[model samples]
Target: MLPFSGNASPLPRNAGVALILALAAIVTASGLLLWLQARALHRGTSAYAALETEHLRVAAAETARAALYVLAADPDLSVDHPGEDWAQPLERDWPGGIHAWARVEDAAAYVDLNNLACSNQPGRPFSAILRNAFTACGHFEADAPVDALADYVDADTTGDYEAAFYRHADAPLLPPDRELWAPAELLHVHGFSPALFAPPAPAPDARHHRDELFGGDFRQATVLLPDAPDAPVPVNLNTATREALLAVAGIEHAATVRSAMSLRALHPFQSTTLLAAASPDLASTLEGAIDVKSAYYRVRATAEHDGRRRSILAYARRDPDGTVHLLQWLEGVS
Candidate 1:
């Protein structure tokens, strides 16, 4: 006989087990739902953050453009409105709680590309002093990778500097006709020092850095001159600060500078070839130092293009009027 005290209700036991299983399933499902909801919320927050960053960047960029327009409209903004410093905040309280501020800058205060002597002038005095410094700075350092760079770029090859560059490098050099669009290309040139070719580093305390001393402005720095448009303010040849002259890489010749000056003194050099013939001493001291035309201007602008933050970098001259132009602009954004 079955246990005398046992209740014969099999359905009761089955129901109890079923209820326990159902409770466990409900708990697991709730946990999964909570996890999915949390994940979705995280994703939404990240997307919102990115969108906000983009909005901030656009606002900052617009501020820069507006300031440039203002300056372009006023020929004497720099002198007359000295307090319109772009570094200051551009604050505003707007509807919908959207506010933006920006900073603006001029690039001429730093090293000017206008003064360097690496252009293709025919015969010009090498700046003994400057060359010595440059050489000491590793240009001619023994065993440097680019020791041959100057000789190659300066050589009067049937091909331009590009052809000479690849020819001088060891076999497997870039194809012979390849062009160098950036100064960093010098690293590939023969006789260049490893130091020169090595990437630049941020200062010990600085949090930023760049690969090239210059990004890609060398191409824009050259000038053909008599052909170059008369700038809003002419690049004073006689008084063209060394920075302005260095911008083209052609003005290194004392003769080129003097001749350019004399032409301005006599009138701007009307023809590129005549620039050299103007002053024998300057012409002889320099090679490829003078040109009758110029197409670019040296410009620098710093702004808060990221909206809430400001970023700054040197800009090569894009045009003479100091309007919106292009140059190497670096952002902290990676």
Candidate 2:
């Protein structure tokens, strides 16, 4: 069987096959190593991106705090109006095309939901005032939800729904039976809905009748929660919109609110006593609901860098001693 004479042997062919297998193994191992290296690099880049975004967010938040401190130190903290330096928007440009900005607003301009209840019980005078405001703004059926909210916060079971109503739901829930720490907590209540709480969108027609009724889409109305549970929530005469003033004073006091607004434009009230003197009728009606100075403010800050964006929302308090303190901080999605 020794073909092509005795010179050819089978061992030579076996050796050649072994060489090809070794080469194939080497190629496969190289490809695997390359893939692993690429995956590691991708993970490192992602981590770095996240770190940079966090830095931007922190920088923006600090900028907001600094501005608030300056505002607190100002000589005249009696009034917070649209034309004030603190109310104006702030922006700054940084290295690597990064930019940061912040905006401050007086929290007293909005209605405090906690003020709706008196000593953990509902049906207080403030509740009726809010209902009247909602009705005047064309949301006539606001009683059920508002009452439900009051029941959810009060320390008793006197709301429109009982504990069984929530317990028997698809997902059982329980009320906190305490003051709400944030306005967004309303979403957890039985009757509260996002549509009712969210800011209204612009109407289809620019000149619509509902515009007048709803105070130009109700941009002036908002809900706020103070850091102090027992502190009185008073609407700031200098910062509150006419709609808010009317809401706190009731629809019947529309003429008085208009007059007060006009008077404040010419000369902002330096004290609550001055506001009372300016509108004796409104002063009598909204004795406990109105004020001339603001103790709380909301700050919104945003930062952008290398096509990435970060945002922060904060609730702050300016003490009577002219010190600013942060009550709550919220970090938003990019």
Candidate 3:
């Protein structure tokens, strides 16, 4: 019996099946080639990015070294002010689509967060500053933050906001009960949140606002310095924001802060004596919480090559002899 009844032919049916298999093979080969090409392209892009990042890192380091030189060349070691060349921003472009930007900031111009851990004092004077800062920046239980921070940093285990409180969070963490290493670490402490530290919206018109006091929103105005235990970091009179000046013990009056800032604007206070002599009302406030010189500075730099970007953050100290020493250097910082 012939398998093909009527006019059916086995040859045509076999040819059709072969044709379908050949088409399937072609489609599979094409898909495989496409995937391989895509993977190669991704690899090339990743390689280029890594190389660009390395180059940018070197560029950022060099820029920071140059900034240190600029800081060291200041003639007046007795004073540090924004009028100096080191305070200016740096922007430059190289021939190979490479661009760099750097800014030098005075660390003394900010409120130091580590001041909350005054281990020796019966009453932490800087606690008032942090509380005031919280009130100014957010609408939370102001005292809660200060007290919680104290618990986090204080050498004590018995507090309402101690390690036990943090243990109940979704991702439990243990508080070191030590000074904060950076400003961002506050997010880990109780009574602190991202909302409290987020910066305000940028101006649509691209305008620079000069009236901000330090720690207003906590993002740009606060710092964590490894200051001596139980000691409050003094705010620099020449460069500190009005908020920083207000946080000082005796400098509470707004009018007095304004008056001193006005005097500072006219001429940088060459000495605390000069400030006191100019205004007796401010003399007492300047006794300990303020100074005319800045010992600490931060160098922030960003480099861009083609479409890739990298950043570096650094902290440095400047001596009275016009020598600058790098304390910490962080790469790939935002």
Best candidate, lDDT: 3
Pitting candidate 2 against candidate 3, the one with the higher TM-score is 2
**Ten consecutive residues with minimal summed lDDT in candidate 1?**
224-233
lDDT by residue for model 2 over 94-131, one digit each (tens)? 66677888888888886677665556322226676667
What are the per-residue Cα lDDT tens digits for candidate 1 across 1-334?
A: 4323456644566677798899999999999999999999999999987666665455445555555454445443222212333324445433324454444433322122223224432343333322332433323343333223333433234333446456564664643222234455555555433554343344455664321222212222222111111211123232333333443233334345444545555554344446445544444533443333222322222233323443332233334454545454444431
Worst ten in a row by lDDT for model 2:
116-125
Q: How do the residues 199-312 of candidate 3 rate in per-residue lDDT, one tens digit apiece?
A: 855544658653344325565446777544346666788898766666653324656667778987888888878666766775664555677888889999888876677788
**Count of backbone clashes for each model?**
43, 0, 0
Each model's lDDT comes to 0.39, 0.71, 0.74
User: Of 1 and 2, which scores higher on TM-score?
Assistant: 2
TM-score of each: 0.48, 0.84, 0.77
Kindly indicate the candidate among 1 and 2 with the higher lDDT. Answer: 2
Off by over 4 Å in 3: 1-34, 120-124, 135-141, 156-160, 164-173, 199-215, 226-230, 249-252, 278-285, 319-328
